[model samples]
Target: MKKQELIHLHGLLAEVCNHYEELSGATVAHEEYSELGIRPTSIHKSKTDHKAAVFALADGITNEMTEETKEPVSAAAD
Candidate 1:
């Protein structure tokens, strides 16, 4: 992915983590790392996993959309 895309994904992951914390009453400690000026390794891993899952979901949606369009590849090539 491009740098912009990766940044966007990171933002999305942060949003997801915030939502998760809100829903489950779980503390996402990583969100507060900046205040302490120390980054936690687990936070990066968590963000990466979240971004990957989001990408996979997007891929699924794209595949579904393509199938639903009913445009044959051969016909489109003509």
Candidate 2:
């Protein structure tokens, strides 16, 4: 693919990552502030693990496209 195409794809992927991040943040916030005290209703933690993976991938592509190679850590110690 051409550089232009790569840039476009990177932008699209960034958009996807941003939206997913919003959803994930909202889920966490709702759980935190609400009085329901309900546990995760879905396989959300597992799913969020993949969200970070996907964001890292998109960031990698964007970095490559922009020559901005940043190393982001995605691990959490439990």
User: By lDDT, who's the top model here?
Assistant: 1
Count of clashing pairs, candidate 2: 0
Give the Cα lDDT of each candidate.
Answer: 0.49, 0.42
Q: What are the models' TM-scores?
A: 0.39, 0.35
Candidate 2 lDDT, 1-78, residue by residue in tens: 543444444456546545755764521222221332212232333444434443455554444434432565568877
Which residue pairs clash in candidate 1? none
List residue ranges in candidate 1 displaced over 4 A.
Answer: 31-78
Span of ten consecutive residues with least summed lDDT in model 2:
27-36
lDDT of 1 by residue, 1-78 (tens): 754466466566556655755775655444233333322223444455545555554454445446555656575544
